[model samples]
Target chain A: MGRLLERLDKVDRRVIYILMAASVIVPLALKLDFPIPIGSGPSMDLYMAIDTLPPGSTVIISFDYDPSTKAELQPMAVALTRHLFGHGVRVIGMAMWPQGASLGQQAMAQAADSLGAEQYEDWVNLGYTVGAGVSLLRMGSSIEAVYPQDRDGVPYDSIPLMRDVRRLGDVDLAISLSAGDPGIHSWVMMAKDTYGVPVGGGCTAVSAPEFYTYLGTGQLVGLLGGLRGAADYETILRERIPGAPGGLATPGMAAQSISHLVIMGFIVIGNVAFIAGRSKRKGGAK
Target chain B: MTMEIVGIWLGALLTLALYSFLYRDNPFYKFTEHLFVGMSAGYWVIYNIYNVLIPNLWDRLVGTGDAAPDMMMIIPAVLGLFMLARLVPKGAGLSRISLAMIVGTGAGLSLVTTFRTNCLSQVEGTIIALTGAGTGQFLSNLILVVGVVCGLVYFFFSKPHRGVIGGAANTGITVLMVAFGASFGYTVMARISLLIGQVQFLLFEWLPTIPIFRGLTG
Candidate 1:
């Protein structure tokens, strides 16, 4: 038992890596799914915010993340697009990050394709605008000033959906799917505070706590935090839409839960081994 | 056989090559690392030239069919050129002008907004009425108020921490530790989510393309 404990304590880092990989891969292969509960928190509030929007209401969804955070943010973007289209809301997709433009296009395309939604009519991709906060400030006055043309080089005025949408104030709500800076902060400061447009965001889990202050201050109407947040939105969609397709984030929750448990167990074992080893050394010295 | 399949295989093989570092660093890992860095650098250069310069700078300076040329764009264009002066030893001082302008503009823009949103509004948010609140709301409000006060006390360096101040500072440390722990846990989850994403892609998307492994995936 003593030798086993010593070996476990001194286990190779590769062994831990393999365990983590197996934890993720096994659950995914088994198609394991856990129940996703919808609590009256930011995720629920975000859903309600969009759910209450009338048909034909315009909403700007900004993809402020790139492929680096695609694992967490992309599903939220796709799910949000589907929810908006399902309600007949006219969607304006934009990106704050450079690479986000293509990622946003792909997400919207996937969702739009399934719903038979027409681009430039039901939705338009504005692509990536360069300036971070400055561009956001400019957008508050005139969106056309920043994005003179859409991603495809079509003039803004030529797009039917964008004709009436002139500035940030014109939109009913703005949702930012962000991984880092020039993101939720920019939206909250410019769109929500400066322009008085209702704003919400979907961010990586690491960023969730920082944004809770915004939620408390009522600057953000709602927030979708990380994969769990995405799963919650998927749950709401599944419950409401009857036949809503499954999302990538929901399946990921099983792996997330299991991996977290494994990590916690390791933490406990590692701490125990350290304490036990320290006591044994002390006893020997005495 | 197809372009799509070829792309999938390429991506899968590259991902495996990068993951090979887990066992031990090898040629494949180094090659993939260099390839990723080189590709990203190249992609960004072209992306900036076309997405930024051509549209914003070039189009504005030289009229693009619908709009007339704006000569005022020259000022910003010059300032942007000054930013590259840092590369030259003698011209490095010229970059200071561009840096100053950026710092000045950013500070000027951020000062009012940061004060309004982060400071005043946050202070306003902290001043909640604890008396009339329900049990849950009361407890939450109390925590908020205590947390803020203790946190501020911890940062109050003017006075030496002793007695009540010491107690408050200690409480603040606990609160800060809890916050840090939560952030760390979320970070762990975020990384795990990324891993899950890669694994899912390998199993569902990439494996299905291979004939032998097709049965392994749903």
Candidate 2:
């Protein structure tokens, strides 16, 4: 028993990696799905904010993440676009991260294609601009000055959707789907606090807690954090919007649930082995 | 045959190659790593040139169409050149001017904004009335107030923790640990979510492309 405990304590790292992989793969292969409960948290808040917007209300959704974080953030971009377009809200897409331009385009394309939303009329992609926080601050004054031309090289003034949208303050609400710096933080500081524009955010789960303080201060109107946050938004959409297609994050949550359990099990085993090995060593010394 | 299929195949092969590092580092993993780095670097360089440099600097300076050349753009263009001066030994000192400008402007902007948003607003949020609230809200407010106070106490290094201060500090440590534990749990969930994404792609996206494995996807 002691030897077994020792071996368990020193189990090969590869075994854990394999277990983790299996935890994710098995559930996915089996097509397992779990019910996603919509809580009265930030996700719901975000949903309600967009849902309550009157038709023709304009909103800016900044895709501030790259492909590395696409797994976590892309669902958010798609879901936000769906909700905005469903409400007949004019959507303006932009990005702080350079790679976010194409990622945003892909997400918007997916959502737009499904909903029959037109580009440059119902929506416009402003593409990416350099200068993270500084650029955001500049947008507070003049968005057109910052992005004189849309992603397609069309003059900003020529785009019907961007005609009256002069600055960040002109928008109803600004939502930043952010992976890191110049994301939620930049929006809160530059757009919300400085410009007094209502701001919301969706961020990777790891950075979610760091932004909770802003929620308390009412700097951020709502937040969607990680896959669970995306799942929550999807749940709200599924319930609210008629014939709203299911999102990627909801199906992924089942795998997340299983993987979390696997990790918890490993933690338990590791702790038990450590305690047992420690007691055995003390007994031998005595 | 199609571009989509070719892209998926390349992505799948690369994903498998990168995952090979799980067992042990090998040539495949190294090759993928180097390819990713090289590709990312090259992509960004081109992206910046087109998205930032040409439109913002070059076009503005040289003028496009009816607009005459804006000589005022020369200030920033020269500053940018000064920034690149750090690569040469003799010109390295010139980089300080641009660096100083950046640091000064950033500090100035950040100070007022950070003070307003992070410090003042957070304090205002914490100082909310403990009364005039529902049961759940009241409890939440109380916890917030206590947590903030105790957490601050823990960081108050000037006074040595003893007696009541010690107890408060201990509670502070507990609160901090709970916060850290929650953060760590979220981090784990984030990582697991990324794994789930990759697995979904492999199973649903990559697998369905193969005739034999198509059934496995369904």
Candidate 3:
């Protein structure tokens, strides 16, 4: 028993890695999916914030993440755009991260298409703004000043969507889907605090807890933290918009939950082996 | 073969090569590592030149017919040139001016914004009324207040902790441990999600090319 516990303590790392891979791949291959329960958490708050906006109201979405976090944050972008466009809300899209510019355009385009909305009329891409928070501050006073032209070099005056959104203050709500800096924090500081605009958004799960204080402070009206948060937001969107299809976030969340349990089990077993080995050593000493 | 099929095979091979590090560092892993680093560097250089330089710097310096050239743009143009001086031995000192300007501006902006968003606003949020809040909200707020206050106390090292102060400090440590544990769990979840995404790509996307896994997934 003593030798066995010791061997378990120093189990081959490859075995653990293989098990971890199985935990993820098996659930995915089997099409294992868990239903998302509706709850009044941050994701719900974000949904309510957008849902409450009247039709024809405009919203600004800051795509502050790049390809690195697409797996985690893109679902939020697609779902949010879907919700907004489905409900007839105009969207002014922009990116603080250069890589996000194209992704933002794709999300907006897909959402608009699904809802049968026309481009440049229902939505416009402002492209990647260079000055970070400074650009956001400029947006508060005049969106036209910050982005004289759209991503395609079309002047703001020509885009029908830009007609109503002359400044950040004019928008009903601002949501930032961010992976790192110049993201939600920048939005809160430059847009919300400076212009008194309400802010909500999603971020990677790692940064979620750091933003909880902001959520509590009401600086961020709501937040969707990581893949779980994206799944939660999808749950609410499906409830509100009947027959909405499940996106990448839901399957990602299902796999993640299963892997988390597997990891937790590993932790418990590792600890038990450690305790058992220590007791055996003490007994030998006696 | 279709380009899509070729691309999938290439991606699967590269993914396997990268995952080879799990066993031990091998030639394949090193090759992928170097290729990735080289590609990323090249990609970012082109990305920045097209995204930032052409539109921001070049356009401003040599404006089109709709916008007149501003001679003032020469200042940034020169400063930007100075930034490249670091590659030369003697002219390296000249890079300090541009670097200083960048650092100074970044620091000044971050200081005010961080203070307002992270400090002042957070303080204002904690001082909410206990009366109007529902029982659940009140309890939540109470925990917040206690957690924040005790967490702050844990970091207060000005005086020696003893008696009542010691107890509060200990409680603060407990709160911090809970916060750390939660943060760690979040980090694990995030990493696991990324892993799951890759696995999904392999099993569903890459494996579908083979007949066996195609039906298995479908």
Candidate 4:
């Protein structure tokens, strides 16, 4: 015990970092899997939110995330889009992040292609915009004000999916996959509150807890929290959306669980060393 | 053969390079970090300028190569330009124009929506099922409301406290600490999950695939 404590006390930060990195990498490489005891509230809410939407309903998936977020947020975005398409939902894709326009369009395009969805008829891309939160407010008043045209520079009226959608009120659901300030909170304040449209979100794990308050307030019907939420969402998708090729969620959960164990391990070691050092000093004093 | 596998392989390598920084501050991590930042920023700027600024605002200004643009684009362009004026020493006053435009637009939205979303909805949520006030949710809410009130009171250190006020204040601290610990646990889980995600990509995506990577391992 004394020897283990002594080693733990002097263990270099580099060693700790290496262990953490391995903790993360090994599970991913070996495909280490773990049990996912679903937290019912957010997971169930997310499942119900998309499932309840009327088939062929023109649902909007706001890919408010960027590449920085693709890891955590993308699976949910893809899963939900798949779910929407599987149920024959007419979907329009858009992004708040400037880079997100292409990323969103690309993600939707890939999913659409994979799912036998045709563009313009099945879906369209509203693409990126400036002004962020303010732009969302403008969307509440008039989506056409901020986005007069789709990504192709054709007017919103020209796109079949966009034809009747002049404001957020025209949409059945507004789902924003967000990472930061200009993401979910922006939509909640702008489109949902102003236009009275139903809204839900998927945010990065760091930002997820702050939004439980919103869920409680009913400002958001559901929130997909970070990667775990994404993984959970994928499970819902595979079950709900028939013939959806799945990899993301199960593999993702494997990674998440391993990392948690790694961190817990380090924290335990750190505490033990601290206690041991204190005891050693006390013995010397005696 | 699969683009999916290719994407995963590259992601795994990048994850390794990034996580390697935990060992020491080295050129590898810095190189990867800078590369990621640069690529992300470049991708963002190009998409925004082309998709957002040019088509939405500029096409309306410079004409769509057919008819002259209407006067509507002028105000926004000018407002955008005024934002740049802050860089000029003598024209620092122009920043106020940009500030006001942004602030006015933001404040206008915030005023209406904050009330609708935060205040009104939160108030409504706090009120339990009036049909069945004896439920568990109602009891939980009663405890919460007390916690919220007493917690707020604890922060009000204007005057000295004695008796019930002080005792309640102490109880509020205990409540806050417990809540904080739960929140901390959740956050710790979330972060560790991120670490896990990166590693997962490295192992499953990169190691078994990618010719050069596979050869090196073999």
For each candidate, what is chain B's TM-score?
0.95, 0.96, 0.94, 0.82
**lDDT scores for all predictions?**
0.91, 0.90, 0.87, 0.77
Question: Chain A TM-scores, all candidates?
Answer: 0.98, 0.98, 0.96, 0.94
Inter-residue clash pairs, candidate 3:
none
Model 1 steric clash pairs: none
Instruction: Report the lDDT tens digits of candidate 2 across residue range B119-214.
Output: 999999999999998999999999999999999899998888998898889999999999999899999989988887888788888998999987
In model 2 chain B, where is the ten-residue run with the lowest total lDDT?
Answer: B193-202
Q: What's the fnat for candidate 3, on a 0 to 1 scale?
A: 0.69
lDDT (10s digit) by residue, model 1, range A166-188: 99999999999999998999888
- Each prediction's interface RMSD? 0.9, 0.8, 1.2, 2.6
Candidate 3 docking classification: medium
Which sections of candidate 1 miss by over 4 Å? none
Q: For residue B166, what is the lDDT in candidate 1?
A: 96
What's the true lDDT of residue A157 in model 2? 80
lDDT of 3 at B18: 96
Model 2 error, position B12 (Å):
0.6
Q: Rank the candidates by lDDT, best first.
A: 1, 2, 3, 4
Tell me how far the alpha carbon of residue A183 in candidate 1 is from the true structure, in angstroms, after superposition: 0.6
- Looking at candidate 2, what is the lDDT of residue B186? 92
Per residue, candidate 1 scores C-alpha lDDT tens digits across B138-206 of 999999999999998999998899999999999998899989998999899999988988898899989
Quality of candidate 2 docking, DockQ: 0.85
For every prediction, compared with the true complex, DockQ reads 0.77, 0.85, 0.73, 0.54
